[model samples]
Target: MPRTTLAPTLALMLALASPAAATQEYILPTLFDVAGVAADDVLNIRADPNPTAPVIGTLAPDATRIEVVEERRGWVRVNTGEGSGWVNSRFLTYRTDVWNEGALPQGWQCFGTEPFWAFIPQGDSVVLGGPDTPNDMRKVQSVLSTGVFRDPTRAVVAEGMTLVSTPQLCSDGMSDRLFGLRAELVIQGNQPRMLSGCCSIQP
Candidate 1:
């Protein structure tokens, strides 16, 4: 067979073997926030095409300002100011809408394990609670599930007096598991509340 024909034949074979062959590639926007660590330590970003491989230094975190990079196999390759490195994709947040300056929604809070949450009025509120530990400054660390919201008609918000947005570091944090969530509740309201967190809800 001609060399050119051979290439096409091989391509077809590979496609047939791949389960995602029929799926269209959709590039989604992502957001990367500084996870509790000082911006200086967040430096030394590296890449990990292979999760099992040691992280390879890509750049200094301070030098790079671009948010959201392409991800592969549950990992995201971030470009530090100096180079590129791979971080677990679960640590980053992906959003379809980018927040515009001075255009944020009212009463909505952006909450996450990455030390940031924005509050917008009339927006979905997320409440995340997990195991309480004495050493944890935030006193809570966990994610929310998509099914958490029960009633769309009622405004969702976070409740409890101690619910302030702060960074909490955990070695086992993963984004896909609802590392952070938004809920609707009154900050000053007095009511018993059960919030979802890192672990599954018991029946």
Candidate 2:
């Protein structure tokens, strides 16, 4: 017939160690979906965070997997072609089901201009293509990361190439779409070549 109580310090430690306390912070360069907007309307991407800021672009009501690279006040920043724009965070919803461990997020793709090329991960292999080069399939050697889920940097090693991406603002140089990751790719051969570009998790 005895009751026990945890000491205040121990209780605090326990609380901090709980699953709730260990929840992931919404880091930048993360994905979001358009929400709370009328299906007939579009979510405006403003040149600034203010509501009256110039409307530079818009996202469809059903838009999903949008890469938000920065956040301030009640607004989020996203790439809009050659530049970036701000959108009201109230109209956006953070995506919960995305990139985990060291695996590439579904729909992950990277591309760059000048020497336009594309890198796509498909299950256990990767598809590398470009305007000047034919599409080639390469086996994935490994996927490496910092091991922290909220950390948004990762590397994918394939048969003849390695791609490393970091959570940063990246522009495709010819699109109105912004990207969340800056990618550097290296292809091995008699003459090794390196390329740089932007990456997006959106399909």
Candidate 3:
């Protein structure tokens, strides 16, 4: 028998032409990012849980409420309001709803380099206060999803705004190795803002 080989591109095409290739064969991730959403680029929803699947729709760069109903490999099924379809799971970020209410600090005095920040929570609302604060302070409400790029933890959102807070801390007490919470603010039609500080849960 003579040895022979085909180009990678042609090989892929032939594989797709095969009936088996059409079958769903990809693995799925255990967790789904239903609440998470795309931050910048549009998120493509496909007919199948695979990138090669036909693109049925696209989500806005700051789109939200995206739900993942299925998963295959790293791809997730999503409902784009238009219809239900699949999209790459990595495209979605942690939904703001992931924030654990119990984990939130009733109030926090965060220590940063120079100007400090304080977080005071009242009812469903929160206040960000600081000497350098542009205004007396900024008031925000806790909403379901935040547009954070990769934060899969707690988040707060308003009409055109979203706020994110880092978890309590990985280390106990103050240590150079222990990095504390740094609140992030995301608002539509504006640049992302950060309130970098290490905080202790209000006592």
Top candidate on lDDT is: 2
- Which model, 1 or 2, shows the larger lDDT? 2
- Residue range 51-142, candidate 3, lDDT tens digits: 68888788676664443334568776544443457677776664433223333423333345444555555555555556777422344544
- Put down candidate 2 lDDT per residue, 105-167, tens digits, no spaces: 787888999898999887799999988989999999899988775777889999889999998
CA lDDT of every candidate: 0.36, 0.86, 0.49
Looking at model 3, report the run of 10 residues with the lowest lDDT sum: 25-34
Q: What TM-score goes with each of the models?
A: 0.26, 0.84, 0.32
For residues 12-40, write the lDDT of model 1, one tens digit per residue: 99988886764323232224443434555
In each prediction, how many residue pairs overlap at the backbone (N, C-alpha, C within less than 3 A)? 37, 3, 2
Candidate 1 Cα errors over 4 Å, as ranges: 1-27, 34-44, 51-66, 95-203
Off by over 4 Å in 3: 1-105, 108-111, 134-139, 143-152, 158-161, 168-182, 187-192
In terms of TM-score, which candidate is strongest?
Answer: 2
Per-model root-mean-square deviation over C-alphas = 16.2, 3.4, 18.0
